[model samples]
Target: MLIKTFENKRIGIDELTGQVISGVTFLNCDFSKVDLSETEFVDCIFYDSDRQLGCNFRSAKMKGASFKRCDLSVCAFNFVSALGLEISECKAQGADFSSASFMNVISHKSWFCSAYINKSNLAYTNFSKVNLERCELWDNRWTGANVTGASFSGSDLSGGEFNSFDWQSADFTGCDLTDSELGDLDIRTVNLEGVKVSRDQMSELASRLGINVLG
Candidate 1:
C-alpha cells in the first residue's frame, strides 16, 4: 500500500485500517471520525489535528506528536512511545498502552477507561477531568502530575509515586494504593471518604484531620 501524506488536508470519515504508514506526517490535518484500526505508524507525526470520534492509532510510535481532541478509543498502543506529546480532550477508552512511555506529556480531559498502562511515565502530566477507570498503572511515576477531577475507580495504582501533586476532586473509589507514595501531599479537596488507606497513610490522614498525636 502506498502511504500518502495528507498534510493540512480536510478528510472526514475515511477508513484507513490495516495500512502501514511508516514515517508519515500529517500536519494540521482533519481526520475526524476516521477508522485507522491496526495501522502501524512508525516515526509518524500528527500536528494539530481535529479527530473527534472513532479513530484508531493502535500500536503506533506517536512520538513527539501533538494531538488535540482526537477520539482514540479501543486503540492498541502497546509498546508505543509517545514521548514529549501534548494531547487534550481525547477519548481513549480501552486503549492498550502497556509498556508505553509517555515522558513529558501534557494531557487534559482524556478518557482512558480500562486502558493498560503499566509502568508508564506520567510525570508532570495534567490529567484533569480524565477517566482512568480499571486502568493498570502499576509502578508508574506520577510526580507533580495534576489529577484534578480524574476518576480512577477500580484501577490498580500500586507502587506509583504521587509526589507533591494536587489531587483535588480526584476519585480513587475502590482502587488500591498499597505501597503507593502519598507523603506530604495536599489532598484537601480530594474525596477519600470510603477509600482504603494503609496504616502509615491513615496516620498521615489523621494528621491532616487535626488529630493531636502526642509523642
Candidate 2:
C-alpha cells in the first residue's frame, strides 16, 4: 500500500500491521501506542509539519526506511529490524533502540543523546557527524562502521567491537570504552582525554606506539 499526503491523521494500530507502505508522507500524525510490528515501510517521510508531535515505531520491522529532518525524539525503536535505514538531520534524544538489528544504516547530523543501543548489531553503518553524546552502546557489534566526526562524549561504549574504522575523527571525551575490542587502532589521532579504557587496553595502545611497557 502506498500511503501519500497523510497529514494530521490519527492512524490506529490495527491499520499498520502486515502492510507494505511506500512513499508515505506522514506529517504531524499520531503514531503513539501503535504496534507497527511485521510492518514494512519503504521510502517513507515522517516529519513535523508546523508541529512537533512525535511518532513511534517501537518494535517495528522497517526495512529500507528513510526519514529526513524529522524530530523522532519520542519514538522507541526497541527490538526493531531496520535494515538500510537512513535518518538525516533528525533528533532522537533519550530514545530506546536496544536489541535492534540495523544493517547499512546511515545517520548524518543527527542527535541521539542519552539513547540506548545496547546489544544492537549495527555492522557496516555510517554515522558521519552524528551526535551520539551520552548514549548507551554496550555490547553492540559495531564493526566496519563509519564514525567519522561522531561524538561519543560521556557515552558508555562497553564491549563494542570497533574493527578498522576511522578513530581519528571520533570524539571520546569522558566516554567509557571498557572491554571494547579496538583492534590495531592508531592512537595518534584518537581523543583519549578522559576516556575510560581498561589497563590492558592502555598497555596495548602503548605497545603499538613503541612505548616501553616494562619497568
RMSD in order of candidates: 11.2, 12.4
lDDT of 1 by residue, 1-215 (tens): 56556555654443454455555556555543444434444545453244522333434445444433443443444544454344433444433445444543357745334344444456655556556666666666677665666777877778778876566657887777777887555546566655556777767766887874454
Instruction: Give the poorly placed runs of model 1, Cα more than 4 Å off.
Output: 1-34, 38-112, 186-189, 203-215
In angstroms, the error of model 1 at 197 is 3.4
TM-score for model 1? 0.48
lDDT of 2: 0.62
- Candidate 2 regions exceeding 4 Å error are 1-112
**Number of clashes found in candidate 1:** 0
lDDT of prediction 1: 0.55
**Model 2 over residues 35-102: C-alpha lDDT tens digits?**
55445555565645366444556556555554444445434565556554545344443344554555
